[model samples]
Target: MMIKPLLLAGALSIGLLSGCATDANRVPEITYEAAANSPFVATNYRAADALISQFRASPDGGPLIVATVVNIDALDQSSTLGRLISEQVSARFSQRGWAMVEMKFRSAVYMKRGEGELILTREIGEVARLNKAQAVILGSYGVSGTVVFINMKIVQPGSNIVVAAYDYVLPYNNEIRSMLVRSTR
Candidate 1:
């Protein structure tokens, strides 16, 4: 009787797993890109573009402070994979018209407000007076299965309140690189 129950459970487990493993719900892979243009990846790229635009248009902003990484705990920035991906992201930020600043070290490359400051997208000591900035962007890049996910948010300085943001997942590998290299305009 115990053997019969065990076999039944085993069969049921296999069925449940098989149901989940079907191709109908498989996630695709993603690749790194210098551009943000593609139908497959447009959703994410558009979101990022819009946020950047909003910050640029905001006159109440001080200096445009762009951040590269903020949620470091959720990512493995020390890993070789992390380093490569981070580099790619940094390059892309510049391609999109974001001013590159230093990382961690506060200097003229970054714009400042009180104790808080901007890094990456602006070199240390670069001068831009600030009553406020157009925006500050902080984001994350990660690999999910074959998919590469880039999540980011735009926030108002001083208050540190989020103004706009995005969470995008892209499939890496071939068949998508073309969409990832469009110039930021």
Candidate 2:
């Protein structure tokens, strides 16, 4: 009888201790918040817009297609960036009545993977005729240091000409503000 009661008491204590350790309510969780002060985001867009303006002033008039249709991240994000930039720039361009090739055109850009230089030029030529584009704008967002370098290149689609380029620095990348302002491209 003594052994039976002792065993029962021991089991109860073990069960209670384990129960407290494994309680669902005690699980930890994490949340992310944007920074209070940062200028990377604002600066980045400014740089991109400046590049666009320069292309408009030039006189190449090639395919007039601005797209990020290259296979970027290891997990193909072609459509996301392609549509995002194209549409965003396209909309901004539209506000001023500037002609731009609609992104609906299904042209693929392949540059041996991550080789944006070759692929960028390829896609410019592939886009169908709408309004001849004088330049093509492209951006890349992977950096090795604290400074994130986003590149925007304006190219002549038909002749594969690089009329203008913009490489903006985003050193102030925080959750609240991003430093992606327009700089010399």
Candidate 3:
């Protein structure tokens, strides 16, 4: 009868739906070794240390201004990862006894709504001069095939010369992917 066919179809649909739901919940389990090797912040700290080692200028030269890291393709745009990396690198510099000028307290640098303080190559001199910064720390990042490459430079504003530079790579994991989401604000 028509009713018997309808009942069989309804049962089959429900069974298929439940099977898909179960499969959707099964995420691959990560190993303990993998979990212990998380390296986003630590990698950045190491890069900062490398830059510090190569730096010939004295820590007492003057205060250093740290700018937020931005996408290499779009210098004005930044994501959560960019801001966090800037903060971590600034902290490392401060811990190393370098006087770091806090960008949030100064309005001389260009700050976008969703992006943090960003000084273009042309505007670096003006911003550094306005803040009386000895050097400005700038960085850009690019992603390629499960890895994110970062390059940081400490530049003397007056001479527009790189005092120190460091380049590093980080694994592009889920956490990084989330942080790379462009701000809607």
Candidate 4:
């Protein structure tokens, strides 16, 4: 009697597990649709274009060193959002016939010096000088509720004067957030 019960239990266990392993039962079928504005790339691009136009209209505008985007609120310290903004803005500037100095080398110098954050305007000017750039393009972003406000500034390194500034407000949706921040494995 004991042997029979044990064998029956073993058979049931195997049957249940085998049933669970089948793809049809394990996962539910779902359809996915392609998004019209994937990752909101166009939004960033528009902001970049606007920034370029604003800067070019200024008297102090010309060759600019694009700096990494700085978050004055300290929320995006570990996020890649700043880098994405910098790249997009720089690309737009380039497309509009403005000379752009890449930010990576200048940023690396500060990283080597152990600067915690890149919010200092004076340091930004120094970086511009190092790259032989006439002006520096620096940006800052802040989030309030479900909205994000981004501000881009063009400043002359010599006079420490802001030549132009552009502001953009965007909804803080998941797609946009993912583009700004990197996902860790």
Off by over 4 Å in 4: 1-36, 56-62, 75-78, 106-108, 112-119, 179-185
Worst 10 residues of 3 by lDDT: 176-185
- Best-performing candidate as measured by TM-score: 3
lDDT of 1 by residue, 1-185 (tens): 79999999999999999988885587555545534444543554465566666554533323454553322444212233233333444455556766544343545443233212334333212332232344566666554557767667765554557777767665766543432332111
Clashes of 2: 22
Better-scoring candidate (lDDT), 3 or 4: 3
Question: Which residue runs does candidate 3 get wrong by more than 4 Å?
Answer: 1-37, 183-185
1-31 in candidate 4: lDDT tens per residue?
8999999999999998887788556645333
Q: TM-scores of all models? A: 0.41, 0.49, 0.80, 0.66
Candidate 1 Cα lDDT to native: 0.49
Best candidate (score: lDDT): 3
lDDT of 3 by residue, 1-185 (tens): 89999999999999999999999998878888887786776888899999899988888888999989989877878889899999999999999999998988877777777688888889989998887888999999998889889999999898889989999987888888899875423
Native-to-model Cα distance after best TM-score fit, residue 144 in candidate 3, in Å: 0.8
Scanning candidate 1 in windows of ten residues, the lowest lDDT window is 176-185
C-alpha lDDT of all candidate models, in order: 0.49, 0.50, 0.88, 0.66
Q: Candidate 2 versus the native: TM-score?
A: 0.49
How far in Å is the alpha carbon of 47 misplaced in model 2? Answer: 1.8
